[model samples]
Target: MLQVFVFNIPVESGERIGFSTTLLLAITVYMTIVSNRLPDFSYLDISYLSNFLLSDVTSGILLIICVIQSLRFYHAPVMQQFPKVWVPDLIVGNPYGSNINLAENGRVVQFTNEGEAVWQPANVFEMNCVAQIAYYPFDMQNCTFGFLPWGFGVKDLFFNVVSQELMNIYFSPNGKWEITNTRLYSQIFYGDQLLRLEFTFKRRSRYEIINTVGPIIILGMLQVFVFIIPVESGERIGFSTTLLLAITVYMTIVSDRLPDVSYPDISYLSYFLLSDVTSGVLLIVCVIQSLRFYHAPDSQQFPKWVIYITKVCSKWKQKVSPKDKQHINDEQIVNSDDIHVPTASEEEEREAPPINWPMISGCFDKICICCFTCICMIRTIVLFVMLTM
Candidate 1:
C-alpha cells in the first residue's frame, strides 16, 4: 500500500514493448585451463556464463569470482601417453585479478581411441574494477571477460576468436539491466594472447523515475499551493516548512545513492535536485512575504508602489468582456421591476472596505501561486525531456 501510494508508476493505455527480431541471451564464455607449458594447441568448447551478481560488483572489496567450465581437446596423441600431463593448474587473465582459485582441480572427463580429451573444473578468480557511476540509474556498465594461456607466452601459445557469437540459450535477463551490446576480440596482453569478451549493459530507469523523480516533481509543484491555503488558518508556514524538509530528505536520499569518487563527474539528477531545493527555499521566502503583509497593522499604510499596482489591477478588473457585460444586462433587464433603487445612505454603507495590507497580501498570493506553479511545472517537463535524452 505504501508503494502504491508513493511510487506506483502509471503506464499509458496504449504503451507496449515490441521486439522486431529474436535475439539470444549471452552465451557462456568461460575458460580456465591449466597444464604443463609444453606445446601450443588449439582447444574447442562451448561455455555457459550466468548468475551475474550486481549488488557487490563494485570496487568496495577485491572480491574473487568463480566460474565452472567444460573443456575439450581433440587430436592430442601425446596427452594419451602421458596421463600425468592431464593435471589442471591455474590461470588468471583479468588485469585486475589478484589470484587464481581452483576447485575440482580439472579432472579428466572422457577419452576416446580417436585422441580426444575432455576436462571439466571450477575456476575461481578475484577481480576489482573501478565503477563509473556518474550517470547512475541511467548509467551503462562495460564489463569484460578476458582469458588467455597462463603457462605460455604469446610466442609459444596463440589465441583466436573462432566466432564472436555469444550463446544466449541458457541465460536469463537481469531484472534491472539489459545487455545492450557485446564484442569479442583477440589481443596480445602482457606478452600473452588473450580472448576478450565485452558486455555493455544499460540500466532500466523505471524504478528511479517512479520512486524518486516523480516525488520530486510532484512536491515541487505542490509548493505553490501554500499560497492557496488561507493565511488566517495559520497553516501556511507549517505547510511550507514541511515541504522544504521533505525536499531536503529526498535530497539526502539522492546523495546517498551516489558514490564518493575521486574524480569530478556530476549526474544530471543533481541538477534536478538543485532546482527543487532552490524552489523550496524560494517558497519559504514567498510564504514569509505573504504572512508579513497579512499581519501588518493598518496604520502602516500601503506604499506608493503598492497603491499604484492595486489601482492598475482594479482598473484592469473593471474592464469586463462583452459576453459578461451582455449577461449582466440581460439579468438586470429581466429583474428591472424587482430591483429597488438604493438611497445615498445605503450606498455609503455598502461601500467596500478601505484597501489594506491584508487585501494586498491576497493579491500577492494569487501572483505567487501562478508564477511559481508555472515555473515548477515548466521545469518538471524539462526534466522529463532530459531524462529521455
Candidate 2:
C-alpha cells in the first residue's frame, strides 16, 4: 500500500527565486514515471503548492517483493510549520524505473468567502522491488523510493514530512514478511532535492527453520547411530551408505527450496553445506574405518594408542558397589561359599592378557558412538545459536 497522506514540500520564502505552481504543473506533466515506466530523468524543478502522497504500499520480503500502488502528486495551500525527519547520507542502491508523464485535472474547493485550487492527475504506478537475498530466510531488507524536485537545489527548496505516519493504516499482513521499521526522510543526492520513502522488512523464518534446518540436523543425528550396530554383523557399512544415499537424494530434492544466493556466499548456504557434509560424509568415513578395525585377525596386536583407549574404557567399566565388594571378599575368604569369588585387587594387579582384534573392534565401536553423539549434538546447538542471534 502507498502511504496515502498529506506531505509538506516547503520553499524558501526569503529567496528571490520565483516559486510558481504553473512551472511545477508543467514539470509534473513531464515527470510521469512509474517503478517500471519512470525513466532516468536528469532535469528537475519545484513548483507551487506541490503535494506528494504515497498510498496502498503493498510489499512482501524474502526477496524484497513489492507491489507498486499509486504515487500521487497534489496541490495544497501555502506551507506551515511541519515536522522534519533528518537523516545522514542514507542511500538505497539503485532501483529500476522508466520515464512517463503524469496526467492531471485541476480540482478546486470553494468556501463561502475563500477558495483553494486543487490540481491532480490520476496516475497508475507499477514498481517492482527485487530483494537482496544474501541473508535469505533470516534477513531484513530496505525498500526505498526517492523523488527529486526538478529545477531545484537545497538553496532554493526544502522538503519535509507533513504526517508522521510512514505506513498506510490499511496495509494487509503478509505471510512471509513483516514491517520492522520505516523512514520518511529527505536529503540531497547530487545537487537535487530528494524526498525518500523507505520501508524495512524482516523475513518470517519459521518455515525455513522447520523444513530445511530440521531435516539436516535430524539426518546428522541419525548418521551417528550407525556406530551402534555390531561390526561382526557386517551391516555397519551398508547402514552408513544407505543413510548417505538418502541424504544426497534429500539434498537434491530440496536444493531449489533452500534460500541461497546467485553466486555462492555465506548465510544459510554455508550453514547448510557445512552441517550436512560434516554430519553426513564424516560419519560414513568413520563407519568404513570401524569395520576395518573390527575385522582384523586375532594375530594382529593392538597399537599402543588402542591399548590406552581400551584400558581407559576397561577401568571406566570396572566400577564396584560396596555391597558387591563385601560379598566378593567374603566368598574369596571361604571355601564353602555359594560361588567362588576371585580377589578384585589380585585381578587388577595381574599382567594384562594379549590384546585381540575383536576386543579392539568392539572398543572402537564404543568410542565412535560416544564421540559422534557429542559431535552431532554440538552441531545442532551451533545451528540454533546462529539462527537466534
Candidate 3:
C-alpha cells in the first residue's frame, strides 16, 4: 500500500507488482505497531526488525542500479568506432532529420535515455569538410563547398557568433547543382562550452542553378560591351559606365554582409579587392575616353594655338581669296573664276597640317584598352560572385 501510494499506481497488470508492494507495506506497518505495543516482543520482534532491514537494503541496491543505468544511457558511448557521443545520424549522407544550425556557432549535445548528460563536443569542422578530403567515410560527394564572407571571424571577437547562412561549400562534379540549394541548413549548434558543426548533404536541384547562373549572366553581359561596340563610341562609354556603377553597388552589399574587421579570410577579402580593382580600371577608361572626345580634331588635325591668339592680325593679313570674295560680294556672279595655281607659301597654308599622330597606332591602342578593361571586369565579377554564392 505504501509503495502504491508513494508511486501513485492504480494496480493494473493483474495486480502483480502493486499487490506485492501493498502486502509488503501492510506487513511492515503491522510489525511496527506490534513491536511498539509489546515491549518484550522477544525473538518475533527482533525477526521483524531483521526483515525490515533486509527490505531497506534491497531498495537501496535497486536505487543504485537505477542511477547507474541512467548515467550509462546518458553518457556511455553508442558506437566504439565513432567515439563522438553526439554524432548526428545524417552526417554520413543519410537522408531525413534536421541538424541545420543557421547560427555561426553550434554544440553537440549528448543525453542518456533518462535525460542525463553524456558529453558535448564543439567544432567548426563539419562532415562537409571531411567530404572535401577525399578519404574514407569523409570522401563523399554532395558536400559543402563555397567561399566564406570575410566578416565570419567577427563572432570570435568577444563571444560566439553564428553565420547567417552556409555560403561556403564544394559541390560534387558527378551531377548538376543549383545555387539556391542548402545541403546543410543547420551547420552549427550552440552549446555552453563549445560549438558543434553538424555535417549534412543534399542532392542538387534547379533552385541552385537559377541563383548561381543569374549573376554569371549579369557579369557576362557587361563583358559584351567590349566586343560589340567600338571602344571610342558612345555606346561603349554608356555600357561600361553602367557596369562600373553596378559592380560598385554589389561590392558594397557584399562587404556589408561579411564581418567588419582587419583580418579577413582570403575567400571573403579576395572578392572585395577584385571588385575594387576592376571598378578602378573601368573608371580610368571612362576618364580617358572623355579626354579623347574633348580633344577630338575637326579635320583630323588640331589648329595651331598661335592662330587663335592673333585673330585680329590673322583677319587683316589673310584677306579672303579674290575668287571667294567675288562670289560673296555678288550672289548673281555667274562667271567661273579662272583657276590660279598657289605658290609654295599659299600651298603650305592651304593644306591642313599633316595629321599629327600619323605613326601612333590609335586603332590598336583603343582596341587593346577596351579588351583589357573588359577582361578585368568580367573576371573580377564572375570569380567573386560565383565563389561567394
Candidate 4:
C-alpha cells in the first residue's frame, strides 16, 4: 500500500521568529539611544560606537547562521530519501566538502572512480576514537619547529556495521594514516591539538631599527644642542623651538599609528611629554634673558675701565694672598664723573712737569676697548661652533 499526505511547514519556529524580531527591535532602540547621547567623537562617545559596531556584526552573523540552518533542515527529508552513489565526482568531491574528515585520514572510505574496491580489508582494525587533534608549529625559544601532536580527545569513530566492539588502543605499529589535503602555507603548529602556532624569527633589519630608534636619537641630539648653548645668549631659544616643532610632528605621527590601548611604561607619548617640558623651560629662560638685556643700559654708569681693572686686580689679589706680603696696597676707583683733572688755568701756574689727564683717559679707553673686543670674539667663536655642531 502506498500512502500520500500533504503538510504545510511554518517558515520559522514561533519562538525563534519572535526572538529575532525582539532582538532586532532592541538593537534598533539601543542604536537610537546611542546616536542621541553621543553626537560628537568625545572619548566616551567613541567607545559607544565601537561597541555598537562589534555587537551588530556578532548579531548579524548569528542571524545568518540561524537562517541557513532553517533552510538546510527544510530540505532534510528529500536528502534522506535518496541513496548515496559514490561516482567520485571530482568536480564535487564530497557532500561535506574537504572538512568531512580530519586531514590525517584518507577521505576515500569505500569506493573508487569506477565504483569498485581496489583492496578489500577483512576485519581491518578501524580507528573508532580520536584521542586528540592539534595544530602546531610554534616558536620554542624564538625558533619555530614543525607541528607536533599537541592535543587528542576521545571521540567515537563509527566502524563497519559488522564490527562487534570498539577497542580503545593506545599505540599500534600497523596504524595507517593519510593526509586528505595539504595547506600550501600557514603558521605551522607542532600538531593539531593545542592552539599554539609559531613563526620563525627574522633578523632585525637596518630599516626597522631606523624606523624605531631614529626619531628618539635625532630629538635627543637636538635637545643636546639647546642644552650646550648658553641660556644667557638668545641662541638656546631658537634651537629649542626647532626641536619642539620636530617633536610636535613626531607626536602627530605616533598618535596616528598607536591604537587606543594605553601603555604604562615610557612610550612615544612620554617622549613628546618630556620634549614639551624641556621646550617650555628653554622658552622661559629665553624670555628672562631678553628682559634682562632689554633693560640693561648701553653706556656704563661708571667708568668701564673700573670694571676691567677690578677684574684684573682681583685675579692678582688671589695669587698674592697665598704668598707672604709685607706691603699694604691701597687702591681707589675713579669714574669719569668723579675724576678731578687740572683746568688750563690751574696748569699754567704749575712749575713742575704738567700732568696730562686727557692722555690718561685716552690710555684707559684703549685698554677697555681691547678687553671688550677680546670678550666679543671669544663668545662669537663659541656660539658659531655650537650652532654648526
Q: What does each candidate score in C-alpha RMSD?
A: 25.6, 22.1, 17.9, 31.9
Candidate 4: list runs displaced more than 4 Å: 1-193, 200-205, 227-236, 263-389
* Candidate 4 lDDT: 0.40
Q: Which residue runs of candidate 2 sit more than 4 Å off their true CA positions?
A: 1-93, 96-136, 155-157, 245-265, 320-323, 327-354
Top-lDDT candidate index: 1
TM-score for all predictions?
0.60, 0.59, 0.31, 0.27
lDDT of 4 by residue, 93-192 (tens): 1122222222233323443434444322122122222111111011011222122222332121211223322232543432223212222122322322
- Return the candidate ranking by lDDT, descending: 1, 2, 3, 4
Model 3 alpha-carbon miss at residue 351, Å: 25
lDDT for 113 in candidate 4 is: 32
Across 1-389, the per-residue lDDT of candidate 3 in tens digits comes to 23334333332333434444555566656666755665665544566565675575466445445444544554556522324344322222222343333223333455544555543333343333322211111112344432222223325322233464545555454454233333323232232122232334433534433543345336544544443464446465556566666656655654564335443233333353455446556555644544463456655653454233234333433455433533355555545576576898786467533333321223324444566666656665765454545
Question: What is the lDDT for 384 in model 2?
Answer: 60
Worst 10-residue lDDT window for candidate 3 reads: 130-139
